[model samples]
Target chain A: MEFLRTLPNNLLIYIIIAHTLFGIGLYDMMFRKTLIGMLISLELMLQGVGINIMSFGTFLNPEPLTARVITLFLVGICAAEAALFLGIAVAVFRNYQTVAFDKLTELRG
Target chain B: MSFETMVVNIYVLSFGILLIQVITGGLIAVLSKSLVHCFIGLVIALIGVAGIYYYLGSPLVAAMQIMIYIGAVCVAIAFGLSLTRKAGEEGLKSPGPRAAIPPTVTLVMLLATLKGLSDRGWINVPHKINEAPVGHMLLREYLLPFEVISILLTIAVIGAVSVALIRGRT
Candidate 1:
């Protein structure tokens, strides 16, 4: 009981949250059926990481502008990643005629 | 042992439930059979993440985490999903079994490395500091990147638009 309250509640919450976000994104990449679906999951994961950064920036570091900066960077990178993936998906759709992800093999001849 | 203690226990239990939602949501997003299911899992996981962020101390980021991330990002991806093709589809066959090992191994190794690194406490955060609002942080010290994000977003918008236009045919 005492230990739970003394457990640095915020740290526990923050760490778990970010990791879960990351795990979701990682999971999607591993198994989801569509490229866009995987990408969407990836975005969720990035948001989790961004939340962790800002929370740390606000509470743990408290003063330095670093974590917040990292969050912005993540957002920018995430947007870029999305665009790249979308473009790839479009190209793949054009070439393969489907977005199912498990059926579009062209280089496997 | 007291009534208050029981109430606290309930609260803690609720927290654990939220944690479960986060973890399971992640799993669902990854393992669900269909794209729409994955998206649904994503939304659930995001909401849970937002709740965890609230527990961490930044309500502002928490709110934005919901608004921009759960709201904007998820909705946008859903639109992309709808726009790309049918939602119920399994779509094209993946690069398949050979392309699988590297990413799986990489994820495992990365998580293990990160866990070890965290244990080492490489970057210890300071005890306390100024916790300003997002507007303050953005308007003052972080203005440049804020502007850059806008430009980046603009470029992405144009890039996506052109890709869509060129997608039709030459």
Candidate 2:
């Protein structure tokens, strides 16, 4: 019970959680059939990466400001990416009427 | 139990709950058929990430995580979902045997790497906390990049609007 209570302080536990998020995101990215679903997976992957960087910065680094700044930038980038991707998804849906992966195979040779 | 120990236990319990929130939310986002549910799950997962950031000692980043992810991104996604018809579909065609391979491989690789990483020792350095506030650093050392990001955001929003509007006249 004491050991369980201390799990939050350990670097390994943070790494494991970040990795689990990454793995889940990767699986979903591959398996999801819609572009928006892929976008959701991509966000998860980015969140995992952010957590990994922040944990490493918190524990291993002498200074943590750089990590925070990087994270801030990551958030900004995520917002931009989400806007662009969703806009594209909307545009694609307007054209094709469906955004399903199997249905939109017009480029297939 | 000692007073300090009880406090520590409470903190740990909260952390555990946040961890569960993140994992469950991610699972919900991925597994649900409805886009609305997926966005809801994403919002929950992102909130958990923000909490984790706060636990890591940066309230600034944590706050930004909430503002950008929950406030901005999720709303944008919801708008997109609303514009598109049949947002509840889970891809039309039946996923064959090949569809199962990638997630299986991901799970296998995750387990293998977890085994390798769990036993490894990482030397923790005494944290040298930041002397300057984040806003000061952003305006000083990170000014150029900060300006670039703002510009990029402006251009992205404009471009998004243009792209979405382009074929509408056709």
Candidate 3:
């Protein structure tokens, strides 16, 4: 019971959770057929990485700025990546009429 | 139980709830056949992650996660989906059994390796933790990276618009 109360305060628990999230994202990234679904998986993975970094920063680091700054930049980069990727998705859909990964085979070599 | 004990228990309970939210939301996002359902799961997961950030002592990052992920990115994805998908699209195709093996193996390997690493004792080096405001560091030390990221965002927005427009035209 005491251990249960202290679980949240532990660094290892957060690491495990972060890893689980990343694993889920990896699974979906490999399994999802559509481009948007892959994008969603990518977001999940990014979230996991963010959590991992933040936890390490909170628990281990003496300088807090590094983690917060990195997280902020990560958020910005992801936003930009999403915009560009969705635009590419839209273009691909326009050209191919479907967002399925297997269907876009024109450039296959 | 003592008052302190009660408070601690509640904290742990809420933490558990947030963990459940994140895991369930991730599962739903990945397992759901419908893209819209996936988006909903993504939102729930993002909210839970925000809660986690708060618990980790970075409320600013939590707010940023909510605003950027749930607010901007989600809306953009929704727009992209609506624009690309047909009116009555029901679900996406699920990968075959053979295709699932790679991800499963990768996940297992990753977790195993990480667990091994965690077993090694990590030192939490005792020092004076700098509690400087985020904005202070952003403008002073991280100014270059901040400016570069802003530029990158601007370029991305413009590039997205141009790419979509060109594709639509052609």
Candidate 1 vs candidate 2: the lDDT winner is 2
lDDT of 1 by residue, A34-85 (tens): 7787687677667666766765565546354567456656766676667756
lDDT of 3 by residue, A2-107 (tens): 7886777788778878888888888788877788888998999999999988887777676766888999999999999999999998887787788887777877
lDDT of 1 by residue, B74-134 (tens): 7777777777775457522354575566456546755674665475332333233345655
Question: Per-residue CA lDDT of candidate 2, range B83-112, in tens?
Answer: 875645563234467667656765676588
In order, the B-chain TM-scores come to 0.72, 0.79, 0.82
Candidates ranked by TM-score: 3, 2, 1
lDDT of 3: 0.83
Model 2: lDDT to the true structure: 0.81
User: Under CAPRI classification, how is model 2 graded?
Assistant: medium
Best by lDDT: 3
Over 4 Å off, model 2: B91-132, B168-170
**Candidate 3: which pairs clash?**
none
Q: Please name the candidate that would achieve the greatest TM-score relative to the true structure.
A: 3
Off by over 4 Å in 3: B87-132, B168-170
lDDT of 3 by residue, B1-170 (tens): 89988887888899999999999999999888888898889888999999998788777888899999989999999998788775434354556676666467656865775776666554452123444578898999999999999999999999998887665434
What DockQ results do all the predictions give, each relative to the true complex? 0.35, 0.59, 0.60
The candidate, 1 or 2, that scores higher on DockQ is 2
